[model samples]
Target: MGRIAVIGAGMGAMAAAARLAVAGHRVVVYERAATYGGAVRRFERDGFTFDTGPGLLPLPAVYRDLFVKTGKEPLEACVELVQVDPSSRHVFAEGTEVDLPNASRAGVVTALDEALGAGAGARWGDFLVRAREAWDRTRRPLLEEPLWPNWSVLAEREPYPSVPHKKLLRTRRATTLAEVGAWELRDPRLTALLESHALAHGLDPRVAPASAAVLPYMEHAFGTWYVRGGIRELARAVYERCVARRVEFVFGAEVTGIVEKDGRATGVELADGEVADADFVVAGVAPGALDTLVPGTALRGGDEIAPQRGAPSRLTVLLALRGGRPEGVAHRTVVHAADRTEELDRLFGERPGFSSSPTVTVSRPDDPALAPGAEHEAVTLSVTVPSGLSVSEADVEGVLGVAERAIPGLRDRLLWHEVRTPADFAEETAADGGAVPAPALAAADGGLLHASNTTRMPGLFVVGGWAHPGGGLPHAGMSGALVSGLIVEGPQFRGSQ
Candidate 1:
């Protein structure tokens, strides 16, 4: 059996460790932190708990498959995967609110029409149909399989087939997501709704390709998920599964560098002046961390160009409420900002920083586990703020001001609150500039993705949100699958069939 060493106890790393152990490899995971789960963390105090990362999970099938492939117990048995109904409530700047039903296109369209105005639903529905085309065209290359050697073809060609629209007596086609919103949706609220999906994933609709339609399409098609007792339970479950499969873990073990001999990775050197040799190494971390492990290792693909810089990390606020969470409230509510253009510019343009009225996503789960008693409630507010910038009380106040519209009496109801910024993320996860990797997309001449799972150094593979198929929970899991496939199945390995 090959001795496999995985760095960082992140989802992708652990996912690979579990599958590798199941494949009869002697796997050992070295985590810098005391706990597992990279971005998915839970904060608890006085019986109040809040998910610090990724309030909801989209495309759970990725984890479901991981459980099915590695063990007898299905994902359902490991944790309660609840499908959030009326999936999300969106409150726009114009005071228009729409409660979209989960995985129901007809219902979503109907709700949008009722709230946003006539024809809005039809326009969105049509866009989704077209988004499906993009999803179908790029799914195998983007998610299900490893990037092919001819990835240039995927990069050069845009999968989304934008329809020609006659504007001012001239035929025009959309190249970016913003054009899609303006050309078809034709309404301010509709445009806001469409762009919000992209912003939530740290992508700029103005620059993100039309193929980004797949973002909303994926959510609408598969549905969003929540894990009972917070997402940390998921991390616990995955860690347990790895243990069950005979994988060993050493917490508080930070890897300082990767040892190399004969131009191949031989093992890793720890921060404590110790080295552990292994036959294969799987790294699941931000690009900065990967660079530190291997001093001169450039994570480049076929062209060997410089790696694309990842997007900024998220800013989250954990709120402990004085009153109980009322029933009939949507589990997730998006408080859309009044000025999306300004916000997007600040986030993605030359002026990268905080927004005075940035869009906020508020998650108020009715689950009893989050509070000490029914009389108390726990709430979380998240915004897609820029990474590497210092966030002030004013910035946090800006998020709260928008969120108050959704929460109603949010200021008084907030018994206590704590804000976690990108700086904190850098401390916790070691991502450069606290930048969170955006999910891989099909756009921008290939800036949408990280380097391939396989690196220049033989016996070393990279896996994480910063790697192939890109970020987000599902993408992270898929990265693990790809890495494991390459190691277990050899160079001839294609992705999962």
Candidate 2:
């Protein structure tokens, strides 16, 4: 059994370490922060708790699989999941409300037809079927495999490798959702609605792949679920599982360098100059930060390996409000501006900042543990902003103003508010530029967006949001699982070495 060093105490690193430990490897997780769950952590102030990152917990099956692989059941440790009805409530500029239900495709289509117009539901049904096919084709092959630097090995040896490689390259060069939606849906509102969901992943629908339309299909098929407590409870549960697995966790141990010998990583040197030796190293941090840890050798030819840029970071505002629940609003709400297209273009193309109409998601309604009382509510308002926008005190007030307009009685009911900009995310999570990595397939050159596979150094592997399968809690966890599985299979058998 080999000793392994996993960098970053995020969900990916924890999951990888747990799996590696179960495989008989001695695993040590070195985290820069004082706690676990890098981005999935929470903060408390004045008796109110706010999740620092990732508010929603979709794809519970993924977590269940991870727990089961480690001889634990997720439900045994965490609260049962409750599916949110009216999966999402979208408020358009014309005051038209689209309440998406968590139901079958036919039922959803019927709801859309009733909510929108004649024939609209049928078109959505056709679109969903196509999306489902794309999802089915790509889910296992591409998403389950590690985005390795050496593709030739898999192409020549692995099962169904050619299909996945072709699918990824095709997806890399596919048209954006905006273009496809324009062709499929006659109603601009419907088109925007479809594209908006894609944008939630920090991708611009105009440039994101058409396959992203699969997101809706998955949400409806699997149903949008929320943990009984806040999403942070899931992270805490995972952390607990790590402890139970006998995985060594060294918090506040920021990795400064990846020690190398004969061009192979042997261990990691902490920011405080302490060295922890191991046979393998797995990084859960962003690819951009690799240069700091491993220097030039770490990202050698990285630019060519995965030539994609990251998506814009976000300006997320968490509001603790004091008021009764608003009528006509569901657990999740997305308020679109009168000129959403122009607003998005301006946000992404020009100055990156919050718009007049930003997307807002209100969760934890059924779960009273998050708010602590029935009279109080917690709402998270998220907007795609520039990669590194700074938030001043004035920005907080401005955001609250926008939130008030989007949701009635919002400003008057506020108990307090906390604002987190891209800069805040960087400081809190150590993610470079506060960017949430996504698939960088927007370029005509077929490069990915945020997903990178630049690992060239021996004994070193990159996993999680910054690498393949892109960002998203489930995909990041799967990335780690894929890497662990590869490591278990023997690096000599894998071409990534």
Candidate 3:
């Protein structure tokens, strides 16, 4: 077995480390931070705890298989995973509310019908059927398999199977996600629901390809979940698993550069002027950091899809409230912006800020572990904001004004709040412009896809949110699997076994 050098102890890096160590390799992880769990960091103050990144887990099966493959215990045996009932509650403009149940197709349809009115449920359900086709068409190629050599085929092709519509004498098919909402769903509230899914991932719905509909379909299919304490617990479990496999970890050890010899990666240079040599090197840092790691070595593929940079990130407000979470409150509630057009324009356009009425996702997990007792509650409000801009108290106040709809008298129930912004993300994950990476989206000539795990450099590879398959928890987990498979199986490796 050979030695491997893993950079940044993020989820992806750790996932790969555990697997490679179990495969009889000496894997050492170097994290710049003093502790593990990169962006999956947790916050604790006044006996209240909150997850600063990725509050919920989707498509957990990816992690499940990982634990089973590497050890005798499954993921559930290590971490407390609880399914979030009423997957989400959407509070749309025009005072419409819909509570979509956990992984129940009929329940979602019924909820939509009750909230959006007659035929709305059937329409949304039918749209999901089409979205299912898109999921099936791209799942194997996009998620399960590595970025193929003929990746341009996925770029040039749109696998959404959009429904055709007739406007006047001409016939057209929905090409963009916005078109899918306006032409197919055809309701203002439903449009908001559909667009919100894309917006949550920092993708502008107006321009996001119709294939993006798969985003919502994924949530509806897999359901949302919460760890008993916080989502960060999942990261802790993975880290422990890596430790159990004897993967060496050196915290606060900043890797300054990759030592290359004869066009192949041979080791990494530490900021302290020390060098750690390895047979293979894996990087989990942002694109900018990756460049700094191994200067003059190009990692971008021939497909022209640069790793997404300066993308929108999240603004999280951790609130400690004076009262307990009431029964029947959904775990998650999306308070839709009153005017989405203006919101999108402000965040993605030249404004370099968020809308006065921005969409806010409020998470109120009923887990007692988060609060000191039943007398108080811990709440988190997340809003998608421009990565390059700075957020102010006024911007957060605007969000709370809308959030009042979900939790009436939110101001009265107020407790002190702590804010986490893109600047914080920059320090935590070294992401460029404080932008958080989204999952690798299909379409647009593969313009949004991430670089392959196996880079042009012979002994260097990329993994984590910044790598192939892209940013969300499950996607990042999958990226680790792909990198490990490639390193272990050699150049002929196609995908995970």
Candidate 4:
């Protein structure tokens, strides 16, 4: 069996390690942090537990596949996921509330009809059908594969050559979420609501690709879920599974370099001066960090990792409220700006260090595990801000002011708050610039310059949000599985051929 060294213990690292271990390869994971789950981690303060990261889990099947492959059932390990009834509630500046239901094609149309206006539902339905068509067409060909410099491999798998290629190419040029929504929905409110999901990715709606509209379809079709205890529980489950499979975990061990010989990965050198050798190495760290590993030489010789510009990071504030749940609010609430264009102009155009009227997500208050009794409520507020910008004391105060305006009595409700800036995220995750790297093709340059293309590196592979499929827990986990399959299947295919 081939010995493997996996760097980073995020979802990507965990998934890769677990899969390889079960496949009979001896696997060792080196994580910089004391705990697992990289960005999807939880932090506790004053008896209040905050998720501190990703608040929603959509696409349960992806996780189910992981559990099944690892010889365990997801439901048996995790709590039964209760799909958020109204998937999300959008609050406009005019105080109008639009509740999007977790429903089917027709049901979603009806919901949109009721929320937006007459005939708007039909338009939404039509848009969704097209989005679903895109989903069906692209699921296997584009999403499932390792999208690197080679377009021929993806092109050969496309069901319809011309249409898929055009659509895929169009995604590269899209700049904002609003531009994408415009191609589908006519209602302004519906458009805004549809554009909100892009915000989760730290993207502007106005220039985001039309293909992004498929995200809502994926959410509605697969449904959004929350783990009973907390999202971190899912990470813990994966970590335990890795342990059961005898995947050696080395926490607080930061990998500072990737050793190369004859233009191929040999092993890794830790920051603490320990060297671990392996047959293959999968990097679950940031793409920008790769420069520290191998420095400017593409494993594939001609291919390179591109640097994307204009992708923003987030400013997150976790508040430990003094009391129980506030009246008339769901688990998730999005407060839209009174003047969105102006606000976005300041946020994206001026490249503000902070945000105004940012989206806020409040987890379930009934969970006593997170807070003792009902006296305290844990809520998290996340605002998209430009990457590389610092959150000064004034910037933090400014964000607090916006939070007060968005939520009634927000200042009074909070017992205390912990603030995390992009700089903080950068320092915490060790990602270069503290910003999640987007495909340069998807961002400013509209060229495939900035993205971690794993195939470009022979024995060295990358997974998670930094890699081709993009961020989010689902995609991150999927990327891990894909890399594992590549390692496990690569030899078998070669032998067969």
Mind sharing the TM-score for model 2? 0.89
- Candidate 1 residue-wise lDDT at 373: 95
Q: Model 3, residue 22: what's the lDDT?
A: 88
- Which has the greatest TM-score? 3
In the range 114-228, model 2's lDDT, one tens digit per residue, is 8888798888887777777766655654466554454333223212111111344464223557766766666887887887777777767776666676677678778887766
Candidate 4 residue-wise lDDT, 1-497, digit = tens: 89899988888779888988999999999888898888877878678887877777888777777888887666446555667767766776676776677756677777777767788888777767766765776565345555545543332332211122135446332233464455446567777777776666766666555555567778878887777667888888889889989999998888888887887888999998888998999888775666677767443333344434346787788888887776655667777666667656766785464444555444443356787657778777777777777777677666666556446687888778888778877876677556764421222222322244354557888777777566778877777777887788872321111
- TM-score for candidate 3: 0.99
User: Each model's TM-score, in the order given?
Assistant: 0.98, 0.89, 0.99, 0.87
Worst lDDT 10-window in candidate 4: 156-165
Candidate 2 Cα errors over 4 Å, as ranges:
148-174, 300-304, 307-309, 326-329, 392-398, 439-445, 449-454, 491-497
- Please give the ranking of all candidate structures by TM-score, highest first, separated by commas: 3, 1, 2, 4
Global lDDT for candidate 4?
A: 0.69
For model 3, what is the alpha-carbon lDDT of residue 372? 85
Q: Per-residue lDDT of 418-483 in model 3, one digit per residue for the tens? A: 999899988999997678887877787786788888777899999998778888999888988888
Deviation of model 4 at 44, angstroms: 0.7
The global Cα lDDT (0 to 1) of model 1 is 0.87
- Full candidate order by lDDT, most accurate first: 3, 1, 2, 4
lDDT of 3 at 64: 99
Instruction: Point to the candidate with the largest lDDT.
Output: 3
Error of 3 at 422 (Å): 0.7
For 375-406, candidate 1 gives per-residue lDDT tens digits of: 99899999997888898988888888888988
Q: What's the residue-level lDDT of 160 in candidate 2?
A: 13
